[model samples]
Target chain A: MDDARRGAIEDFLRAASGDPALRITGAALLSGGAIQQNWALDVVLHGAPEAWVLRTDNAATLAVSLPRAAEYALLRAARAADVTVPEPLFLCKDPAIAGAPFFVMRRVAGIAAGHRVVKSATLGGGRDALARALGQELARIHSIKPPRADLGFLGAAPADAGLAFITAQRAALDRQSRPRPALEWGLRHMERTAPSPVPTRLTHNDFRTGNIMVDEAGITAVLDWEFAGWGDPAADLGWLCARCWRFGNVAQEAGGIGPREALYAGYGDVDDARVRWWELGAHIRWATIAIDQAERHISGVETSLELALTGHMVPELELQVLRMVETAHA
Target chain B: MHEPPDAANLLETARALLLAELLPALPEAQKMNARMIANAIAIAARAARDNSTFPTPPEADLIRAGAYDPGTPGHDAAVAMLMDIARARCAVSSPRALDD
Candidate 1:
């Protein structure tokens, strides 16, 4: 952050907090969130040190993501639903303060790296505990239903979440220059065996391990609300159990942290079939996202080798989906 | 025959040098980028060695239209063909994926 912007942010915080002497002690851009930039902030509020995160938009962002204000509303709703999330403080819509709209929230402490989280023996207390905690967190997230004015931006609940996802993925595939037969096969299988329409609830579209903050005791907070929407609650569980999110620890199943039963044990009784269906959807969604990321590079929107490499992940996801369909329990 | 040090071999040699000499000297922040570059080079080398191309299969539209649903005519055959294609792509893009 530049001195001028830092001074502007300090003035904004001072006005918002009603503390004349409030000062920003430190500010540093955090790594991660390809679509968003989070700046770790140290503030002196009321003569005490406060750790907070200022979240703002990146130079390039996916069209599907919610804006900062919408995300702030989501955090409030999730917090009200008893879901563990950072406490949203203030939202600055005026771009002059930081050259872009941003929001401030209390920074929760935990290690969130997917590879390290999956490989660690002690993080999240134990694998089982972490899995259960994740399940419980998801259950809390699902507890939030639609018809909420604050969450009205999510639009009406899908009549059939399965069909909605299938339609979306098909559209995404159609947008690609190359035809993906494997993804098509998976979509066809899903269409043939899609479960009956279920009541839609708030689904964290990206509730995998890496999105959560975890310490030795357990989960400290759930991160990333940009993709939350009214959909099948099982979608969250499926996303958690998706093979790609497991970071190569495929045997564990539940975010590569623990068994499915352990995760389910924390949440209430869940239909296994629905979770399986959404798990397939999760793979399709991930593959689509990878393609989209690569498109950003190919289209000359944002050129980066990371995005280019991500496109190569499509075949592996396709293979996973194919194997799942073939080995699906009768 | 052209030569022993072909494009694929040359790429492999360059990658080996990068890992041996350049990777260790890079800063921590740039290491991941270097590794990704190395991985991209490795993938390119494999692709050059294979010298294969994957055209979109005719079954894509059929599968999208649900002709590949279970018990449908040619469903199994189409699915098998897709699996073969996926495996072949993985061979060049990510061979370890096949093992998994």
Candidate 2:
């Protein structure tokens, strides 16, 4: 950040914190969020050091992501529900502070890298325990239901989550420049077998492994509430079990952490059938998202090798979707 | 006729050199990028050798138009066509993802 921006942020922190003597010791941009930028801020208040993460939007962001203020509210709600999340400290709406709306939250330490977390034998209680903990964490998130005035931005919970998602996917497909036949087939299959509405609950729509922060003990916090909304609880379960999210640890299907039984055990009791159905939904969702990410690269909106390669992942995702559908039919 | 070291063979040689020489010398951060470059080169070499355009078959168009919803005639054929398309894509992108 520039000197002026840092001074503005320090001023905001002083006012928000109600500590006139607060000073920013250091500020550095942290990497990894393609949609949002995270700045690691070191502050000293009355000689006590503190670490905070300032989250703000980049020039271009995913259309589905919630605004930073909305995301702050989500973090607050998630924290209130005893979901492991960084404690949201304050919100900065005035763009003068950082040239964009942002929020500050207490930084939590953990390894959130997908490949490393999945492969590590030492971290997160060696898979089974971590899986169970994740399951329990998801259940707590689902405990927060819709019609919550605070989460009004999420609108009303869809009467049928499956159909609602399929509609959204189809609309996304329509926006694409070219027809994706494999994705279209998957959507059609999903539409044909759309499930009845389960009880609507607050769903962390992106509750896969990569979105979680894991320490040696277990999950320290569930990160990225930008895609959260009211939807079928099973969608989270399916997303966790999706093959694409498994990071090559295909046998340990529960986010490549542990088996489905362990995950279910953590959730207390869940209908396995519904979760399986949403697993199919997860594959379709991922395929569409992969295409969208690729389009961002291809259209010159954003140019990154990662996004370009993500487009290449569609074939595998398509194959998974087809295999799952065939298995369901059989 | 082209030289003995054909395009595919030349790519293979370059990839071998990249992995053998440049990869070890790269920093930890650049290693992943180097590997991705190598993989891209391999895929490109494979595509060159295959020489097929990898077109989406006509049945996919029928499928996209909803001519093969479940229980409809040609649904199985449509599914077969889609599987073929997916398989072809995997052949270029990640052949190991395909079923045995």
Candidate 3:
């Protein structure tokens, strides 16, 4: 913690909750999220010695629309309505807080790893129950109505979010990026048969199995709201079921836990046409991210083994889009 | 108590080719795919072998940290352990992906 940032934390704490003597006791780095860094902060002092988590963007190479303060506000708002989330304390926009901006949320313990709970027969319930719960939670999140002013921040509803996403990806690719035939095909197909009408709502953009914390009993908390924005709720649902998010049970579409029906049931409606369109769109969105990931290797990032494999998923997703498009035509 | 179908065998074979045949032909720079392909093969093999088996303590031991890393592949045993664990978890692959 730098001098200016530490002082900012103190100031924000005092202003938010009217406490001045809060002291930072301990802190340790936690891992897993690719785009950001989270620190397990053990804060203790006068008043309530609250435990907190400090999150900051990890030296980003790509630009994004959401900001830390925005994430903090989203977390705060979500927590108030009983959405399972890390209780946010304060957000620091000051760049001096260990480089990029950071936000503090009260820490809670539960496994956020998909592999951990899904494999544990005791925890996983041997059924698709958890995936159903995730669907329900997502529906609850989409239930919230953000202000009209906030809609612009989100850009647009779910219908064409996929198109906007494809445009962004194609622009990135056209800039001397690596040529991926699979991505091209998926984009063209999506363009040819873009879903009709738009369904917009607040979306937890990265709501996959790994992002949520689960215990033996049920879901403990939802983490990582950085990608949270106003968009199609079903887009997030399809993202939850995207093959890229499925670590093992490729056949089990609901975050690799169960089928789409179970997920749909959890969402409180099985026949919502909006979700199906987003489902195909989600596949295209994932393919775009995957193709760009492959290009990142060419773009000279860390070039990890998994990143390259992730890049290869574009063709697979393109095939999925093609299949869905053909199925739609049929 | 049952083995995965021939599909996993095919996946295992494809994964092997990705690592053994395709990976070796590439330069050090392109070796980023070596560990993932290797881990994918390892997991597919385990998943194929135990697709029908109930969740056992021994089967829960196959996550490979090395496969998760970019530069250094963790020990093969860890990878095997993760692969084994993935057999039970429908998330039988890398739960988290490395940046592409």
lDDT of each: 0.90, 0.86, 0.64
For each candidate in turn, the TM-score is 0.96, 0.94, 0.69
Off by over 4 Å in 1: B1-4, B53-56
What lDDT score goes with residue B97 in model 3? 29
Worst 10 residues of 1 chain A by lDDT: A321-330
Off by over 4 Å in 3: A1-18, A47-49, A124-126, A146-152, A155-169, A272-274, A301-309, A322-330, B1-100
lDDT of 1 by residue, A179-211 (tens): 888888888888888999988899889999889
Between the candidate structures 1 and 3, which one is better when assessed by DockQ? 1
- Every candidate's CA RMSD: 1.6, 2.1, 14.4
Order by lDDT, highest first: 1, 2, 3
- Look at candidate 2 and give me any clashing residue pairs: none
Ranking by DockQ: 1, 2, 3
Is model 2 an incorrect, acceptable, medium or high docking prediction?
medium
**DockQ of all models, two decimals each:** 0.78, 0.55, 0.05
Check candidate 1 and list the clashing pairs: none
What tens digits encode model 2's per-residue C-alpha lDDT throughout A270-298?
A: 88888888888898888888898888889
